[model samples]
Structure formats: structure tokens, C-alpha cells
Target: MKRTFHHSLPAFITIIFALCAVILAGNAISLYNNLLSLRNTNSWIEHSWDVKDRLKNVNVLIMDAESSLRGYYLSGNKTYLGPWLTAQKKIEPEFKAMAELLKDNPVQSKNLVELKALFDKKIQLMKEGLAAFNDGGLEQIVMLAKTGEGRSTMDEIRLQVVVMESEENALLAARSGRFYQRYQIAVAVGMAINIMALLVLVLFYQLIARSFFKRLAAEGELKASNEHLEARVLARTEQLSILSRHLINVSEQEKAKLARELHDELGSNLTVLAMDISMVTEKLRPTEPELAERLQRASATIKTTIGLKRRIIENLRPSVLDTMGLAASLMEQASEFEKISSLQVNTDISDEFDKIDPSSAIALFRVAQEALTNIAKYAQATQVWISLRAADQGLRLLIADDGIGITAEALKKSKSHGVIGMRERMLLLGGNLTVTAAANGRGTVIDAYLPFNPAAQADASVAG
Candidate 1:
């Protein structure tokens, strides 16, 4: 259950985070749309106000023209013409502006057109009344006013202005309502987004807290289990290490003993048997040819057996290793490998370790020996380089092969006991061994470092 939750927790967190991101993004887009709509509504409201103001101005100007014309007819004063001419000049642009404004609304546009026609008629009547006063005095003006055409036209213009104002008022109300709606929606979206953010944060925090508490509860148990397992593993490894070291010592002793016995007993016996067979063959050869031939065959067989025994002794414990030291033994091994494997063996042997520790010496030799054997069997190389040298008050033996490089995966999967045995030998002697790719990246290099002071076995600090 714990493992399943641990595996599933990341997916859960990812989904929550994705949801939060989407919510925030959606809120932003909604807010932008609301603001845009609100701005458009506001502009429309201002436009309605402008159109209503222009319509009122048109009505007021037409009224001013009619009033001025009546005052001028009554007083025959040129000063009354000032406001009449101003109204006449102003109402045209005013009507033009209103027409431009109402062009989008068919109903308001028709009303504005009627209003313009009425204002034009009122101006024409005003002009005619002035002309009548100039031509026939007060009687002509009275005659024009009595017909009541000017009064009716003025009334129609007022009515048209009222109609357009009513339309603008209705449009303004609708736009204002829509703006309020968009504003409320924007406010609600903002609040919802904020609330969602708070909830997400609270949920995330609670999840983290719960997970932390659960992990804290299990931490002690996990630590105890790990400690117990590690203690057992450490104890088992120590025992195995002791057994391995003892076994290697015992094996070396047994091999040395067997080699001595073979040399002393079997070698002497075989030499005596060969000597007796040779003497009998010469003596009894002419007397009995068949017997002599049997004697010669037996002598040859005995000689072959002696040679085999000698080789076995040499392999068990090389005499040069005991007498000439590590370097000579390693070179002999290298020279022998070169002959047997038909591969190039370049040597850089040092005489610095002539009086080295026997245990250390054998460990180094075994590492080289094992590595060279692996190279012959597995490396399929054409050339090998062997180096035994002193480095940082310790012995460093390096062997490299220009063969297919070793891979980390191959090392992990390899089950070669020679590698294990060589490692164990070095660990027993406070030394370290490493196998790596060659510097040129096309081969394998083996490095073995044995510290003179066994306690100072830091891996690479004093190693070459």
C-alpha cells in the first residue's frame, strides 16, 4: 500500500497542478473579455449622450431662429439679426454632426432627416418674413405669421428631437445594464479564481503535510531494518574475508609442499627408472630386439612423465618467485604468455620492490596473472603492456590491452572467479584493484596499487 501510494503521489500532484494552471489561465481570459466588453458599453453610452445633446442643440437653435425673426419683425432692429444669423450658421453643422452620429441607427437617422427638413422649412419661413418686412413692412410680416406654417414646422422639429432623444435614452439604458452585468461577472470570476487558488494551496499543503508525517513515521523503521541488514552483511563479509585469506595462505602452502614432494620423490624415482630402462635396452638389444624395443618405449614414456611432472610443479609454485622476487616472476609469466598466446608483451619492470612483502608481492603477481589470463581468453588483443613500478611509496602494477574495451555492464554481469579471487587477494593485502577503459578509449587497463603501510589504503589518493 505504501509503495503504491508513493508511486501514485506524483501523478496526483501533477493533475492538481495542471488543473490550477488551467483555472488561472481561464480566469485571465475571462477577465480580459469582461474588461473589453465593459469598455465597449461605456463608449456606446457616451455616444448616446453625445447624440442626445446634439438633438437638443438643434431644437434650441431652431427656437432661437424663430424668436429672433419675431423680435426683428416687431422692432425692425438689425441687432436681432445677430442671433438669427448665428443660429442659421450653427444648425447646419449641428445637423450634419447629428446625421453622422445617427447614421448607424435607421430609426434615429429617419427622425434626424425629418428634423433637418423641418429646420430648413423654419429657416425659409424666417427668411421670407424678413423679406416681406423689407418689401411691404409690418403688414407683409403679419400676413406670413398668420398662415401658421412656421409654428407647425417648429413643432414638428421639436417632436423629431424628442423621438431621437427617446431612442438614445433607451439605448443608453441597455448599454448601462450590459456594462453592469459584465462588471459583475468580472468580479465574480476574480473571486472564484482567488478562491480556487486558496483551495489548491490548502490542498497541496495538506497533502505535503500528510506525506511528511507518513514518511516520518516510517523513517525509524526503515533505518532500523537497514541497520540490521547492514550489520548482518558486514559480519558475513568479514567472515568470508577471513576464510578467503586463510584459504589463499593454505593453498600456497599446499602447492609448495606438493611441488617439493614431486621434486624429491617422483622426480628421483622417474630418473632411476629411465636410467635402468636405458641400460637394459643397450644390454639386451642384440639378444632380443623386441624386448629392447619395449624397453626403449617404456624409457620414452617415463621421460615424458617426468617432463609433465616438472611442468606441474612449476605451475603450482614457480621457483623464480621464491628465489628472484616479484618482478622476475611477473616478467617470466609475461614472456611465457607472449610465447603461448602469440601476442606482443611490452614490459616496464622495476627493481624497486626487490625486498617487498611476500604477501603484497604475491597479491600483485596474482592480479597481473589473472588480468593477463583474462586478456588472453577474452580480450582477443594483439598487444599487451605490463608495468611494475613504485608510486607514492607503494607498488603500482599496471597491465593494459589494446583490445575491445571492457564495459561497465559487462563487468557487472561477468562471473569470472579469477577476478573475484584477484580482488580478494588485494583486499587481504590492503591494496586496491581497478579495471577501466584505456586512455585512448579503445582498450582495457588494469591498475593494482598496494600500500606499504597497510592502514593507509585510500583508493586513489596515494594510488597511480
Candidate 2:
């Protein structure tokens, strides 16, 4: 049976698509969260920058006022007062901006309030001292400006402002760091999501391909199994036919055995008993010379009957085969055939003989006997060679006769039951028998090869 790939493909594709969709959805959620975190970080960074810039402006105003006061005291310069006044005008706006920028923080708001009060007090004191100086009280003005009390108040106020600015800068740095970390995290998460998505896609593709391949493999296996089953069924049918033929052959052999026993053993004994009775009757006759002649005829008749009986028994089953094993039995049969038929027979047998099952030994002996009989009766052969050898792989039996060789057409057309029986017996014992014309048209040859190792039967079982 041919198989198709489309049978399970749709289901596999659908499952892969579902898995990929799930992975894509998960990655999208991760990316969205990362983006939100990054946006919040950017907003915090922008606000921190604004606060830092306002703080810088406030610091510049305070520095300008301090420089003006120092110049006025050092050289008693009235022109420095002009710059001081301009700085004073700018200080309020800078302070207000700082206050507004830090309004969200309680500590910074309190520090701004204290700074404002300190600034106002310093400005008022400077203005009053300036007025004193203009009215010719310069010494007192200088004295007041340089006093520890005024310096202490200014120091406290500057320290408070510095603390507040420092706090604000620290907060700004922290927020900047946080913002940078969030941005980096967002980028990392996005990359991770992208990588995961790619991995999922690859997995999905592999799963789909694997599923298709598995289906194809399964279908191929099923087809091969079916083909194997059909071949086995056909082989079994052939074996059954061969078995039927074997049963018929066995029945015919049994019948032949029974007929030979009846004709040889019992018939020969009865004939001998009758011959003895006839000799006695002749010996009792009135004429003594006639009795001698009749007795001599009876004795000759008894001898001929006994000889016929022995030949019949031998034909049915050879006693040598029962006692001497396959090799000796074959040699004895060949000698008897040559003596009886006036045919030249030659034999070559290996001394390395081993015991085999009685049935197998008998079958091989019968096959040899039949081959020799056929050659003697029909081949009109003058010379025959029989060889029995133990080869490396198995035992081999060869019988060749110098006779009128059979043509290929005759070999094909002839329905020779003797050869067929020989082949069947060899096949039953896990062996093979082959018949071919000898080289140069010298004779007809028969070869029987049988394995010595019975383990070869296991191979036949496994194949079946």
C-alpha cells in the first residue's frame, strides 16, 4: 500500500501554530511592561534636570551678593553697592523659583523659607549700614559689617542653602541612575523577548517537521509489514503443497514395503515347504530311479525359490543399510548393482564419517540406491563413479555415469519422479540436490549437498 503525507499534516501544523501564537503573546506582554518602566524613568530624569538647573541659578545669585559685600568693605567702594542692589533684585526671583521647584519635598521647602528670611535680614542690615556710611559713620558701619554676629547669621543661612542644594543634587543623581538602569533593563527585556520569540518559532517549525516525518515513517513501516505478510502467506501455501506431495510419497513407500514383505518372506517360506513336500512324495514313489530324478528336480526348484525371495527382501530394504551406516550401505549397493547388471562401478568415500539421525541416513542411502538403479536400467552406461566426502561446510554425495547424456530439452521435458523424490527428501532435511549433464557430454551427474550443522534450521525458522 502506498502512503500519503497529508493524512496527519494538518493537525501537526495547527498545533505548531498554536504554540507559536502563545509564545508571541507572552513576548508582547513582556515588551509592553518594559516600555512602561522606561517611560516612567525618562519622566523622572527630566524633572530632576529642571530642579538641578534652578538650584544652580540660586547659587550664582548668592555668590554675587557675597562678592559685592566683600568689595565694599575692602576698598570702601560705593560702586560695588550698585552691583549688590542689582543682585538683590535678582535674588528674590531665584529664591522663589527654587522654592517652587522644591515644593514637593518638605525638607527642601523648610530650608528655602529659612534662606529667604536670612537674605532679607542681611539686605536690610547692609542697606542700613550703607546709609550710615553716607552720613559719615563709616567706621561704625565697617565695624557692624565685620562683627561675628552678622558673619554667624550669614554662615548659618549659607549652610542651610548648601544642605538643601546638596540634598536636591543627591536626589537628582539617584533618579538619573534609576532612569539609566530602567532604560537598560527595558532594552535587555526587549532583546530577551525577541530572542525567545525566535526560539519559539524555530521550535514550532521543528515540531511540525518532526511530526510529518514520524507519520511518513509509520506509514512506510505499515506498508512493508503488509507486503511481508502477503509474501509469507504465499510461501506457506507452497509449503503446504509440498507437504501434501510428501505425504503421498510416504504412503506409496509404505505400500511398496508391505508388498515386498508379502512376496519375499512369507511366500518364499511357503514355496520351500511345498518343495520339501514334493521331494518327500517323489522319494516315496515305487520306482527308485524315478524318485531320485523327481527329488533332484524338487531340490533345484527350492533353490531358485529361495534366491528369488532374498532378492525381493533386499529390494524392499537393504540389511547392510540398517547395520553399517550410510557410507558402507552405498558401497555395498554399488557392488551388488555392478555384479547383477554387468556395469563398471567406482567409489571414493572419505574415512571421516560421523553419526546422523537414522531417518536422514536412510533417506540419503535410498537416494543413492535409486540413482544407481536408474543409471543401470536406462542409462546403458558402461562406467559409473560414486563419491561421498565430508566437506568443510557439509557432506556431499556425487554420482556420475558415462552414458548417453540427456539434452537440455529432454531434462526440462522429462517428468522423472525419481529425481523429484530425491530433491524433496534433501529439502526436508535442509539440504539441496542438483542434477546436471556431465562436462563434454560424458555422462549424467547427480549431486546432493547436506549441511552438517543443524543450526541452519534456525535460520529457516527465523526467515519464516
Candidate 3:
């Protein structure tokens, strides 16, 4: 429990710290957005005021143009025209600046357009009157002054300026409200973040203590669960062992039964065929040498077929293992294996193995069989050594080769059916099997040991 607590404490604290950081980071982003909104709102509010100032400047320029023209006309002085010319130069530039600023606002842009037209009309009226007075058409000037067209145009220009100024004032008011709203949100978020950080710092230790207890409980539950699982696993393994042992016995019995059927059925037929061929060869005419040779060849082929059938039956169950016992069977097996695989097999088998249990005898023979088969297929060896020795209460069989050695990975491979079978058979007999590299890692070696108890065997036989 203490070990688990030590292991989990650091991890738990790290998780808590990460969670706190995420919360803080998310709130910090919110606060930053609030401040950003405030900044944008203040910027637009200042822009609206600047736009209002431009509008006022434009209106003053228009008024200056009207007043300067009249002053020049009435007083007959060129100095008054200077102010009008300066106003004219500056007015169009102001209108272009305001247009650029209010382009994004549909209402304001429309107002600016209308206001520029009014100012243009007012300037045109003033210019005509001045022109008429300068041309010595005093009557034209007087008539224009009487008609009040200049007065009405100036009035319209004034009204248009007011309209533009009103729009900017309304935008300024709205931006001001927005700026204050964003300021309030930023303040609230900052306060909330501070409170959350303080609470996290205060409760961190208490959370660690609670997490330790919960972790301890989980560990205890896992321990008990592991124990129960182990018991169940052991029970299941025993059942599988029983099933595997039963399967091996059934397979052996089936092989023996098949061998018997082949011997009784095909063996008799082949033997009769050989006898009939011999009889036919003796009765053939003296001049018919070809027919006689054919009869002799048929007889010889029948004899070879019988031998082949016997060899196959022996391979299936090995009657020699049961009849002459494991020692003689191993010798016969080695001799045949030499002829087929072209590898020399040296044996040091104990004669006493023949007196042992039949099951142990067959198991040992099968171990040798499987080992030799593997050596032939994969070992690439020129020589093999087979040894059987009495050790303690069991007999140990070792089959080693002088070929390319086995790999540790191949020995441990789960899908190696031959290796698995030999191991399981030894395990069924309360023994074990091992495969390894030979001396100097030159080739592969298989070691199989089976515990023997004569009394137990007798008792088992009686029980059976």
C-alpha cells in the first residue's frame, strides 16, 4: 500500500496541476478577449469623434467661402477673396478624407455624398455672384442677392452638415457604451480568475490526501482480484492438462488401430499375390524367358510392397517399441533414419529401459522420432548423438545433433507444434522437456525426462 501510494501521489498531483493550468489558461483567454473588445470599442469611439471634427471643419469652410465672397463684393477689396480661395482648396480635401473614413457605414456614406453636393451647389452660387460683380454687372449681383438663392443654398449646406455630424454623434455614443460594457466584462473575469487560483492553492493538499486513500482502496481491490484470478487460472490449467493427456492417449490408440487394420487387410492380399506369382513363374514354358522374367519381377515387386507397408505401419505406432522394447526400437529407428536422411546416429541407450512402463517407453521413442525429424528438416547436421541414462527416480533421454544450432526464439515460439507436443507429453508424465543448442553451439539438442514409479504404475493399472 505504501509503495503504491508513493507511486501514485506524484501522478495525481501532476493531474491536478494540469487541470488547474487548463482552467486558468481558458479563463485567461476569455479575459484577453474582453480587453481586446474594449480596445476596439475605444478606437472606434475616438474615430467617430475625429469624423465629427472633420464634418465641422468642412461646414466652417463652406461658411467661410460665403462670407469671404460677400465681404469682397461689398467692400471692393481683393484680400477678402484670399480666404475664399483658401477655403475652396481645403474643402474638397476634407470631403475626400471624410468619405474614406465613413465608407464602411452605409448611412454615413450616403449623408457625406449628399453633404458634398450641397456644399458644391453653395460654392457655385457664391462664385457666380462674385463673377457678376467683378464683370461690373451690379444689377446681376443685386438681383441674385434679392432672389435669396445663395441664402437658401447656404441654409441647405448647413442642414447637411448637421445631418453628418448627427450620424457621427450617434456612433460615438454607441461605441462609448460598448467600451464600458467590455471594461466591465474584463474586470469580472479578472476577479473570477483570481478567486479560482486562490481556491486551487488552498484545496490542493486536501485533494492529495483524499486521492491517496482512494488509490489505496483501488490497490487493495486489485490485489484480491489478482489472487482470485490466479486460483481460477490454476484450476483451468489442470483441466487443460487432463484434456491434453487424454487427447494424446486417444491419438496413439487411433494410430495403433489403423496400423492393425492395414496389416490385417493389405498384408494378407499382398502375401497371396506374391505366392501366386511364384507359382505362375514355375509353370511357364522353358522357351518363354521374357514371361518368366516378368513373373519374377512381379514377385519381387510384391515382396517390396509388403516391406513398404510394414515400414509405414511401424512409423505410425512402431510395433518394435512394444515388442522388443525402447532400446532395440531406437537402434532400428536410427538405422532406418540413417538410410533416409544420410546422417550418422551414435546411441548410448541403457538396456534397462525395456523394463520400464510401456507408456514411458513409447513417449521416449516419440521424443527421439520428433527430434530426428526436426534435425533432418532444419538441422543441416552430419551426425547425431542419442543418449538415455538413469538419473534419480527418472530416465533422461538426450538427442543432440552437430548441425546449425537451434535459436532461442525458435525454441520459445508458441506455434511450434512438434516442440509443444513433446513438452506437453513430458508434462503429462509429471516431467519436463527442454530444447537447446548443442556443445559449442554447433547444433540443436532435445532433452526429455520422465519420472518413473513402478508401484504407482501397478496401482494405476489395477485401477484401470
Candidate 4:
């Protein structure tokens, strides 16, 4: 069994491991997909940030150009002219950079190109007006500046740049939303996998534990059953031995009673008759005066014979037991024992004896007899108590003595088959017997409990 369990354990563990492997494989696939999605999302974000940075630089250049134009219009300083020319040179390259960055987006690229063309026209007009001012044509320059054509051009360029920036912002928003959605999906899938794995592991663990406990319980039950069977067999063998010994004892007792009757009763009677005949012959032969004394001796011998015969009959089978039932017989026996042994005997017999079967009555009486006899011989007891009563589902008999108690070692030895015999009888009758030290460790108490079916007894009564 141990080897079988060991082999089966590995198989069970392997089954659990296989389940975990499947779960891990599924999670790994999800992880791979999530990684791919994340990488794509990161690339999109980096492209959007680069476009936004280029747009920022373009807006800065437009601001510097506008500031320089306003300065030149107010003071017409050549120092402001340097900044305006530098801003002018920067515009084309910045617009071209913005256009290239938005090449993947047609709408944003078109807007960038339109803004660049508008800014170029505005720069050409400003250059023509500045060349006129440098050649002493101040009136034309004033006319161009006052008509606000430069401001109108700046406005159109700004509107196109704003349109291009709006397109880039929309692209960034869309990519961000996709990235967030993918991240949430990955997280949800991972959580689901983990939860499923945990549930499976928990269920498998419970199954294994339940299986282990079930096997353990079966093993324990088998062990207990074997022990119980062995005990029952030993008890049966001991009971047969005790029965054989009891039968022998009963036969010897009967023979002893018969021999005593023959010797004490019939032998005495014949001896007295022979003596009377001898006395008569002597008296007749010599006319003896002692014939009267001899006749009285014969009469006394006849009385002794009658008493011996009565005793023998009582010993063979007490009439008191048949007439008054078990309780009275037990009381009489106890009284006789007390008288013979000079020990005090106390008894409490319930009036429910009529409720007991005759067989059960006999068994209980014999058990009491044996127990008390043992007490008389070995207990050195000053007092003994016997009780009989009805209990739930059974009748109970208690025999206790205030004497030297039985030792634990003595109880274990089973050398005295007397107690074992009593226990076996009770067990065969579907009853139980217990022997324990009396209260206060003063002596020993023996209790026997026997159950009977009142209905069965009633049926027997009707049959009888």
C-alpha cells in the first residue's frame, strides 16, 4: 500500500503541474501580445512628440519675426532689421522641417506647405518695402506698413500653423487613447489568468487533501477492524475453556453431593439398624438391662441421618431458589455465607426480578455466587454489598467489597479465569461487565449490565 501511494502521489503531482503549465502558457501568449502592442504604442508616441517639438520651434520663429517687424515699424532701426532678416532666413527651413515631420499625415503636410507659401509672400513684401526705405523711398514703405498687408499675411500664416498644430494634437490624442486601451486590456487579461490559476490550484490542493484523508481513514478503519476481530476470537476461545472447566466443576459437585448422601444418610441408617438387632439379640440371650440405652442411641442416630439427608438435598438443588425466585435465593445464600465466614453481607434486590428471564436470572445468580466466593476466600473483606436493579435498556448487578483491592498488575495478568469467565458469559448474553477499584481505593467493585427484550420475554411467556 505504501508503495502504491508513493507511485500515485507522483502522478497526482504531475497532473497538477500539467494544469499549471497550461495556465502559464496562456499567460505567456498574452504577455507577448501585450508587449507587441506596447512597443507599437511607444513608437507612435515618440513620433508624435517629435512632431510637437518641431511645431513648437516653428511657433517660436514666427513670434521672433513678428516682434522684429513691429520694432522696425515703430522705430525703423537697422538693429531691428538684423533680427528681421535672421528670422526671415529661419522661416523656410523651419517650415520645411515641419512639412517633413508631417509627411505621413497629408492634411497636416498640406497645411504646413500653405503656411510656408503665405510666409514667403509676406517676407518678399517686407523685403521690397525695406529696400525702398533704404533707397530713400520712405513714403512707399509707410504706405505698405499702414495698409497692414504684413499683418494680414501674418494672420493667414498663423491660421495655417494653428491648423497643422491641431492635426498633430489629434493624432497624439488618438495614439494615447489606443495605448491606454491596450494597457487596460493587458492588465485585465493578466488578472483573469492569475485568478483562474489560483482557483485551479486551490481546487487541486483540496482534491489532494481530501484524497489523502480518505485513504488515511480507510487504513485506520482496516486496522481497527483487524484488532476487533482478533480480540473477539481470543474472547471466544477463553469462553470455551471456561465453559469446559465449569462443566467439570458442576459434575464433581453433583458427585460429591451424592456420595455425602450415601455415606451420611443411608450408611448411618443401616448401621443403626444393625446395632439395634445386635442389642436385641444380646437382650434376648441374657435378658440384658442395657436394651433401653441401646434403643435411645438408635433413635438419635436416625435423627442425625434425617438431618444429613435434608442437607444433601438442599445442596443438590435448593428448593428456596425454585420457590422464591432469584432474589430470595441469593439473599439466603449470602446469609449462609456470612454465617460460615463471619463476614457482614448487605443486599439490595429490586422488585423487578419478575421482569427478568429465568436464564438471565440463573446467569446473574451464578455470577454473584462466584464473585462473592472469591471475595470470601481472597479479599479478607469485613463487608460485602450486592445490588440488582433495572437500568435503561438493561438490568444491572453490582457486587462490591471493602477489602484489599486488586492491583493493576493482577488485573492485567488474567491468571484468574474466574473474572474472564464472568465477562465472557455477560458478553455472550449481549451484556458487558466491568471491574474497577472501589471508591477511595478501598476494595473492588464488579458491575454487570445485561439487556433484554421485553417483547421477546412476553412471547416466551405466552408460549410457556
Using all chains and alpha carbons, the TM-scores for the candidates as numbered come to: 0.47, 0.44, 0.50, 0.39
Local distance difference test scores for all models: 0.84, 0.74, 0.84, 0.76
Please give, for residues 1-464, the per-residue lDDT of candidate 1 as tens digits: 45533545587688888988988898879878987887898789889989988887877787787788776875577888888899988998998898888888898888888878888888888888888899999889878878989888878877877888888898888878878887887889888887887778677787769878889989988999999999999999999889988899898889889999989977997899899999999999999999999999989989999988987887788788888888999989989889889999999998656567667776787788789889998997999999998887788999999999888878776685776677778888778788899989988998888878543333322442
lDDT of 3: 0.84
Q: For each predicted model, how many residue pairs clash, with residues at least 3 apart or on different chains?
A: 0, 0, 0, 0
lDDT per residue as tens, model 2, 1-464: 99866655577668767877876786678668767766776676676667666656655665677677666764466777666878778888887777777788898788788878887877776667666666765567667767766677668766876787687778767876876787677678768766766666576677768878999999999999999999999999889868865785685478468756766656766586767767676766756767766777766766676676666666666666656667887888888888988988999976454255555666677779889878977787899999999766678899999998666676556587788888877877678998899987778999998776565435433543
Worst 10 residues of 3 by lDDT: 1-10
For model 2, what is the C-alpha lDDT against the true structure?
0.74
Task: State which candidate, 1 or 2, has the greater TM-score.
Answer: 1
Best by TM-score: 3
Ranked by TM-score, the better of candidates 2 and 4 is: 2
Candidate 1 — worst ten consecutive residues by lDDT sum? 455-464
* Shift of residue 150 alpha carbon in model 3, Å: 99
Model 1 regions more than 4 Å off: 1-236, 453-464
